[model samples]
Target: MFKIGWLRIANGLIYLYILAPLAVVIISSFHPGEYLIFPPQGFSWRWYEHVLMSGRYTEPFWNSVKIAVVTTCFSLPIGTLAAYALTRYDFRFKNAVQSLFLSPLVIPTLLFGIGLLIMFSALGVKMYFTRLVLAHIVLTIPYVVRTMLASFSQINRSIEEASVVLGASPARTFWLVTLPQVKSALAASAFISLVMSFDELVVALFLTGPGLNTLPIMIYSDIQFNLSPSIAAISSLVIVATLAIGALLIIFMQQRTRKSTDIEDPKP
Candidate 1:
């Protein structure tokens, strides 16, 4: 009983630590004052209206959406392939290869961004939408690979063997058998990749030039020079968008899991 009481206290503290900032930001966004403040002087939707009407905010928000969508599109396939190769097949330097793919997660984002910027400059490569898309993909692929790897580990290999034994080609077996088993992982990875790419600022700060600004970069720039409640409003919108995507992904995975279970355990 003593331990249980201690655990409850610890959990409450953890919850406060995680939620305190979020609560403040949400409250501050509605401040009647032009500047941000906690226990806002009064409630108003002026900041939210300002954020919605400003092209500076809307443009970057759309840029972030495009970057995240493109990044997820490219990262999912490449990450899934890397996950499959690492998990299913025995190859030379298998562990080393997996480590290399996941290394971005450990490396400092600033360092990675600096290195990429230097390389692109040396190549005389212009920073364009396509280049920004590629940069986001690099940051996002590690999350995809990690999530898919977890899914691959949980799946049974016998299903793939059975498909092959029934005269399915290797590619067909993978598409028809292995892919279905790992669909939940793919869904989860895509959502994770979207969230990572959407909120990423460090790499964008180095790699993006004018006209390629992302939402987080815009927010950072605003905070550096001003303390407007509009910034808080933008942040609250981002938080809502992130949570909506996460909830949708969860529903998709849960539905897929139920369908898979029904297929595997059919009854009269």
Candidate 2:
């Protein structure tokens, strides 16, 4: 009984620690005052109205979405292929190569940002969108690779072989047999990559050019120069978007699972 009581207390504390900031942010976003404050003065949607009507936050938010979408597209294929190579092929320096690809995850992000800036400068690459997309892809690929590696590991090799033996081409076998098994993992990786790329600011800071500011950059700038509650409104919108994405992914995966299970167990 004592142990159970202590465990509940610890769990409650953990919940508080995790949710306290979010609760504060949600509550403060509705503050009627010009400045951000916890235990908000009063409820109002003026800040949200400003965000929707003014192009300031909306532009940067759209920029973030565009970059994150492109990054996710590139990261999915590259990371999945790298993961497949590591899992399905036996070659020299495999472990080394994997480590090299995953090195960014271990290295300091600030250092990576600096290195990318220097590399771009040395290469005379001054294009803003190009640099931003490339940097975001680099940052996001590791997430996909990590998820793919785990996804591929759990796949049944015999099922793949059987597909190939039963007149399916290698590409067909992968698409029809191997791919569906890991669809959930791919979705999860895409989510992670999208979220990370969307929120990424450190590398973006070094690479962003004129008119290329992302949402986080905008928020950071706003916080530095002003104490407007508009920041809170924008942040709340982001939180809502994230929650909506999470809900959609969960629903998608559940439906996929149900279909897969239905296919396996036919009823008359």
TM-score of each: 0.92, 0.93
lDDT of 1 at 21: 93
Worst 10 residues of 2 by lDDT: 259-268
lDDT of each residue in 36-92, candidate 1, tens digit only: 778899889998888898676998999989989989999999999999888889999
The root-mean-square deviation over C-alpha atoms between each candidate and the true structure, in angstroms, is 2.2, 2.2
Displacement of the residue 61 alpha carbon in candidate 1, Å: 0.6
lDDT value for model 2 = 0.89
Backbone clashes per model, in order?
A: 0, 0
TM-score: model 2 vs. ground truth: 0.93
Q: Which residue segments of model 1 deviate by more than 4 Å?
A: 1-3, 258-268
lDDT of 1: 0.88
Q: Which residue pairs clash within candidate 1? A: none
